[model samples]
Target: MVTIAIIGRPNVGKSTLFNRLVGKRLALVDDRPGVTRDRRSGEASLMDLEFEIIDTAGLEITGAETLEGRMRAQTEIAIAAADCVLFMVDVKVGLTPQDLDFAELCRRTAAKVILVANKAEARGAESGVLDAYSLGLGEPIGISAEHGMGMAELRDALVEALGEEAFADPLAEDEPEWWEEEAPELVAEGDEGEEAEAPPYDDTKPLRIAIVGRPNAGKSTLINRFLGEDRMLTGPEAGITRDSISVEWDWRGRKIRMFDTAGLRRKARIQEKLEKLSVADALRAIKYAEIVVIVFDVTIPFERQDMSIVDLIVREGRAPVIAFNKWDLIEDRQPVLAELREKTERLLPQARGVKAVTVSGETGEGIDRLMKAIVETHEVWNRRISTAKLNQWLSRTIGHHPPPAVAGRRVNIKYMTQVKSRPPTFMISTSRPEALGTSYTRYLINGLRESFGLFGVPIRLGLRKTDNPFAPKRKRPS
Candidate 1:
């Protein structure tokens, strides 16, 4: 794909424009200048064109005596790799020397340049937009990226400069249409006469998993042990794993893709630009994983941050299993395990009956058990409950503990169906979904998890009020 890099000075709405073009908030946006420190790349489409768009660090030619020089180096690297450059200038500030310098740099690279004068929604910036012509780059496109103005003109400019044939709009929605068309091809070989064969589980396919935890946890060490080498540099340094590193390997005849994420610190400690990017990357990895194994240090297994991470995994509807790493360092095992179980129940009541396996990565003890837990969790993650069995369970559970009376009227939860699997989401149609309280939702979710043996896998319970289609619409009085 053609790579287009957005290069400019700080606080020129480059990140905002990046988010608008990509249709996702992959890059962080803040009022402060220089919020984006790292280069973030995403596939973007304009009209019929598809290409890779990179949001680069703001250009600042600080002398080689400071950290700003290092950041500038990173930006230069991105510019070198770009097929085209979107040279953004702030019309509000108008024609700074930095913009001119960056424009010169783009010219030297011999890459296609599209000069954009951002923050041009107000009438005051028209002269600045005109002034951008003197930079020797062609007429600058006046755009208010934050307000999403002038997108059509910007699209035309991109197509004209980059060639219209280079662009193609990517298939819309989360799932592509080609996947539906190719469903028959994805069927298993032996199941020709079956209604529709499920996709075969390829052992060669990477088993994507994330290792997540709080700062100072043994996440890095556990990852190193899993790989049987010091693949990731580890030390007494906390939060050393800054970015989520994808390490591929074959584990016991199964191809595994492990993401060693950075230690997620509290929001207060995440003031640094690099740390913020690291956290965002880790969250992205968690969302992309098939299974998430939260690695906590045995000494302090269920800290607030650790529980928060687990809660996030469950909320995202991903299969999660807790791994107590550094177990060899723990002095008291039984009491600690008992307390940990109790805390897990209290803190993660949503993930009731989730499995927590104790393992010492340093000694390789209990590694087999951890692997077994992972396979079992994977099975539950992919499990689909039959409609008949689900409704039966729902009926029995509601019968045992009925929903509370709402304002002298009793609410009725009619039918339940497994909407989707891969964390096993269920949709329940009810007479009054809005009246269902948090306590009641927990009761149903717990019952579903316990009855369906969905331990260690996140179970989602969605409540929807069934609309009465047969009921006549109210007629307006003439």
Candidate 2:
């Protein structure tokens, strides 16, 4: 796919437009300037035109040793590698000295450039659109990434600028690296017709896993262990990490994006604005994560704060696996590990039978088991059940313990079918759906989990009344 870099000053809606094109909230968006520190890239498709888009940190002039300077260096790398550059300007704020400076940098790069005037839907932005001509990058395209206007025109402009590069080979650009990992045999009905068969499930998008826990829980240490190097700054200090940094890696041929987030301190203790931003960033990481590894130091395994973080992960419906860090420090490994398992099962029974792998973040023990558990839990989360099998299981379950009656009328459960997965939501058609109690809902949820080997994943059960389509026009009578 062609690479397009969204280069602009801070808070110009670059991340927002990135999400708009990628069709997911892959990048975090906030009103505060410099919220995005690292460069974020994702595969984006816009109205049949597919490309890889990189959202870079906002440009600024600072000392080379400073944090802002490091951010500028990453953005420059993105600009250099991209086949096309989107020079975004905030139409509402108009152009500034920084905008001119970045425009000059883009011009020097000599890459195909497209000037995008974001937030152009607002009033009085016409002048800002007119002023963009002074930037010396051809004609500026007036568009609103927030309101999603002028996309057709934007597509046309991209095609105009990139010309042949605008159209990429779908197979080469979009086809995932699944065959590189596993080669499934092809099936044919005739004599010798042979072609490669693609995997039924999509293993393309990197599985996004966020490592989160209380302060000083060895979250960063565990990430460094995974990387086999000191990738993230680690110390004895609490809250060493202030921003959510993500790294992409291929583990056992399965691509994964691991997010090392700031320690989530208690709300009452968060006094500084920077800490508040860190917590928000951490929460955003959890929201988009497929699996959340709740890293815990074995020395102090289950604090109230740790319990709250695990509860939050479960409540968010992300598959969670507890990685007990610093396991090498423990003396009585068997009993202590057993108690840790007991505490997890007792405290977070909502995620019944949660996986807890003992690992030494410093020594890298049981890291393989932890990775396996993560992949297993993700598969359970993505499980889909056939309608026939689901109904069969539900019927067998209800027969053993029938639904309790309400107001002396028995609730009739007609049928059950899975509506979706990735948190495996199912719908149960019943006569008196509203009459069912949360207790009964819990029963069905537990049964669904147990029967389908859904052990630790969250199951959402919904009750929908089966309507009679052709029976009785008398429903609306008089």
Give the TM-scores of the predictions, in the order they appear. 0.58, 0.63
Quote the positional error of residue 363 for candidate 2 in Å.
1.3
Give per-residue CA lDDT, model 2, range 1-478, as digits (tens). 7899998999999889988998977676778888776677777988979888988888998886776776788788889899899999998999999999999999998488999998899999999999999999989998888878989888998899888555768457445542122232222223122322212455554588999998888998898888886556566767767667777788877788889898987899999777887898899889878899998888987888888888888888889899988888899888997898889889888789788899888888898999989988888887777666777788898899999999899999987766666777777889888898999999999988788898887888888887877777565757
Q: Write the per-residue lDDT of candidate 1 for residues 14-119, one digit (tens) a residue.
A: 9899888888776777777876655667767655566788886678989854545555676777788887888999998899999888889888983798999999
Q: Give the alpha-carbon lDDT of every model.
A: 0.78, 0.83
| Residue 313 Cα positional deviation in candidate 2, in Å, after optimal superposition | 2.2
Best candidate per TM-score, number? 2
Native-vs-model 2 lDDT?
Answer: 0.83
Candidate 2: which stretches are off by over 4 Å? 1-205, 468-478
Q: Which stretches of candidate 1 lie over 4 Å from their true place?
A: 1-205, 473-478
RMSD of candidate 2 to the truth, in angstroms, is 8.7
Error (Å) of candidate 2 at residue 73 is 14
Error of 1 at 128 (Å): 34
